[model samples]
Target: MIDSVKTPRSTYRQEQADATRVRIADAAQRLFARDGYSATAMEGIAREAGVGTRTVYAVFGAKREILSVICERWLERAGARELAREVLDTVDPVERLRRSAGWLTTLYSTDFDVARVLDAAVDEDAETRELLAAKLRGRNRVMDQMISSVEPELSVPLAEAQSMFRAFAAVGVYGALVVDAGWTPARFESWLADALVHQLMSASAVPDPAHP
Candidate 1:
């Protein structure tokens, strides 16, 4: 009878490859973040990772793919959607909305690489652009889910919840862009946090007569 257990060779090789790919991408991220995408060459990434140029290309295909990987990493590090969800779990609808907006602004202001990679992704390579779009769509879905969670605590329609979702998204992206607008990192972060908090408070104060 054939053995039921799988061979370890495939699993071991896959794990090894994943480690190598991660190293390459990490190097690419650092290089791309320091030097704009246009200036970061494949050879530089290989040198940084102590890998061959062929290996870098084999792992990421091109510079744009590397950028996408970095962006994905940045988003994951932020615990972004989960943060928004946490706010929605609160019983107070106003607090929930305030926390949601604050969460986004804080995330964007705090994570430098995320802002950098996202800025680079815009109007960049086709692959990177598509990947960024997919990320945004996924993030928007997360926002909508959070909105639905808060609706029970407020007198708002599901449509209004979705509106809040879009509004927060715009605020977050705008916050990210502001980081590049010549403000010191600390100043930008503080101003963004305040701006988003004010917006959230204003939104939450809206009288929804339909309050259950």
Candidate 2:
């Protein structure tokens, strides 16, 4: 006869705590989007989250931390890091740039609300601005690497190619097209694919724009 093993009480408690944190973060995300970060009070977050104010403080030390949690969750949903890997793995120069375009569209499409909220709060607080800047730097670093993977095949210099890639990934471009002009995400992706393939790759490599 063998004895059965059971999960530890502390592990269960940690899981419960993590779930509570997520709930608080999600509630805070909605509130922050509706009310600018400075305007959002901790009590409101606790009330919206259905948790005690103390619990909110215990889980997240400050309101900015909640923003950080929300950004982390958004990145997971957007698959930002994972998709960069896909671009690096792609062998064809055209397909790789196209995947990079798709990655940018996915970044904004999955959580444009958060992006808008962050932009709105950027000037509201110093801490918030730095936090957003750090995230932007991290993402841009990955984009640089993805473009570097195809440097040998690029028609332009590496610096020029990277600059073009970063420009296309700008949130402003996406907002102007999809949010303002009401272009669908798919259309933006298609346009970006054509633009990158034509401008970055050699003429021999530029094929008929693959419409997906």
Candidate 3:
């Protein structure tokens, strides 16, 4: 007698369900970016993705969960600074400071949807205040690396990098308020570029006592 081997039906169904969840999330992201999160509904996402409304609720539970997923994706892309790391590797302190400050301006500028969603999300959901705090930790880590780029010229101990990082974060906060709050984009970028460059140069101007 020959024995028959069979593939599991549940395995195929699980893969299909996972694909459907991804599609729903992508559709919701596009809508949320176009229309603010409050305006985008589960039915809209279902229609956009060609799935049933039940599918969206089944996968995401609520609209807030979907918004959180989209915001997470947006921040990941906006703060990606690996290119800055490579170029800064060969550059001197002056050039590295310029590049680092310029990169911050880019990150805070309206070029990315995260900048817009950030304000809107916080206003709508109190829970997202914590989400923003978590994202702040990530931004601080990036700023710390930028500070390290200029550490050779810093007058204080390496631990003082935290202050320099905070100054950079202030630049970002002001940049977002000025530009995203309807201030002139050109003037905001120009002013921020000049201010951040000055701050970094001043903070790292003196030679590190620790180094000497």
Candidate 4:
């Protein structure tokens, strides 16, 4: 019989590495949120994570990579891709728009701090600005996909539909109405659903304008 080698040791090592990555990411997120991206150094992140500075660098390479990981983590935690799948699967145009709004609401509400941190960092860091641009492009792509799903029902031009979708789904709009204006999440969602339906749907699909 051939000698069988155990793989548990390797599995355990991989688990340990994953745990270390989570710890470092958590520490970096805290520092970045509290201190701003530029102010939070790798040394500080390593200290917060209880690891050596070289270890942080070895894992992430640079602070920008750490921030990118944080953004990706936030997106995963917010179920962004899953929500997009759900939106794509829905057949009704109005429902698709509502789901899209819901996705944005969930994302902004759950990761508002990360968004704020990224927004602030963009002005001061070129790397972060590029990251933000990539994120925005991703956002626009999602919007385009969503708009295409309901294109058959829309009366407006595709370009106009996409622009309106992007405007209504903006994070800043949610931040303003919910974060700064003190509106509840449910209220924001309700308003967003109503606004999107009104703005994107054809006149035949929309509620009577005189009814308020």
Candidate 5:
């Protein structure tokens, strides 16, 4: 008979620490969204989370670090890693763009407030600006990967492809259409899919505009 391995259980202390971390992060996100990043403080987060300020500081060394954690948590919750894998694994260029649009729509819809808050703060704070710059760089890297994946089917030059990808798949575009213009998430996704296919794909690869 083969022996089965048992999963290790979390200790009480570990569980308590995990709960406190969650509380701090949740409080921070709420405050950041409501008050903007510059106006929110670690002390306020601690008070909102019902923990000591020292505990918040000990768990997250700085306010920026907490913001970083918030971003990470949002990405995880948005299923970004899994979506990236799905996009990469897809071989069809049109399908890849569609998947990418769906992923972006879901991401923006889930964290629009956080993105708005960060954008508002980035202009005023050096640290926030750096963080925003890093995020844009990461987004560009993903776009580069996506462009490379669909290179064989592209009608445009790589630079144009990059530009088209950024413009069509931007979160702000989604926000404008879905949040401001009152389009449904499904409508935004369909429009993005059609727009990307028309802009980047070859004539042969472009799906019927009316069908998307």
Candidate 6:
């Protein structure tokens, strides 16, 4: 029946609210990237979104919360959490390692402005630092799980393998290779895949490092 499929009034209202929050978060992210995070204010975000300042305050309450939403949206665009799951789910050792590289490459290429903003945010108050730290811890946990999936097949110890994963996934490598040196995203992905395969996989079990 048509009535059975009708949208609830409450659900519609909630969806509208969520959409407004995303708009504010996205507008704030642009400002944070253009101006430093400390320099970008809630008023600027409201002005950019063409919304009242009160709406932003009502939705996110603080700039830090808006940043948190931006980070989440960025990750969603990167397919990062899903890719991490795929890496762990992969049965082949070579394939698993290669998929991890894909995940890292995807993240670095997916609007790296969030990383730039977070770097600037580190100089902020302790609460903001804690938020960043917590986010890093969550990411590391996922990385550890991905590496652990192929641990016995790795050339290095578990801790060492995880450390390698962390190092190669750093924004510095992406910045240097892709942003500074001007390598294309595909080229950077290829380089990282090869580097990771050589560094982490045993010679006998290794396959071509090209991502699928």
Native-to-model Cα distance after best TM-score fit, residue 163 in candidate 3, in Å:
7.9
Candidate 1 or 2, higher TM-score?
Answer: 2
Model 3 ranges off by over 4 Å? 1-19, 75-81, 84-91, 105-111, 148-194, 203-212
Clashing pairs in 6: none
TM-score of 6: 0.88
After superposition, candidate 4 runs with Cα above 4 Å error: 1-7, 124-127, 207-212
Q: Model 4, residue 8: displacement in angstroms?
A: 2.3
Error of 6 at 42 (Å): 1.2
Runs of candidate 5 exceeding 4 Å displacement: 1-10, 124-127, 207-212
**Candidate 3 structure quality by residue, lDDT tens digits, 1-212:** 88897768998899898889778878987787799877888899999999999989988898777766766665556555664565368467755655665666556652455555555666555665776667667777767777676777755555565575476456446555664576664555566555545554554463465895
- Candidate 4 versus truth, CA RMSD in Å, comes to 3.6
Position 22, candidate 5: lDDT: 86
In candidate 1, what are the lDDT values of residues 151-179, reduced to their tens digit?
55544567765775576456445545565
Q: How many backbone clashes does candidate 5 have?
A: 0
Candidate 2's TM-score reads: 0.87
Tens digits of lDDT, candidate 6, 1-212:
55558898999999999889888988998899999899999999999998999999999988898989899999999888878877778888887888888887788789888987876687888888899998889888988888888888889999999998899888778888898999998998888888988998887787545842
Cα error of candidate 2 at position 160, Å: 2.6
For candidate 2, the lDDT comes to 0.87
lDDT for model 4: 0.84
Comparison by lDDT, 4 against 5, better one? 4
List the global CA lDDT of all models.
Answer: 0.68, 0.87, 0.67, 0.84, 0.82, 0.86
> Where does candidate 1 clash, by residue pair?
none
lDDT of 5 by residue, 136-155 (tens): 78767877787778888888
Model 1 earns a TM-score of: 0.65
Can you write out model 2's per-residue Cα lDDT over 21-105, one digit (the tens) per residue?
A: 9999999999998887879999999999999999999999889899888989999999888888888889887788888889888
Q: Could you say which candidate leads in TM-score? A: 6
Candidate 4 lowest-lDDT run of ten: 203-212
Cα error, candidate 5, residue 121 (Å): 2.9
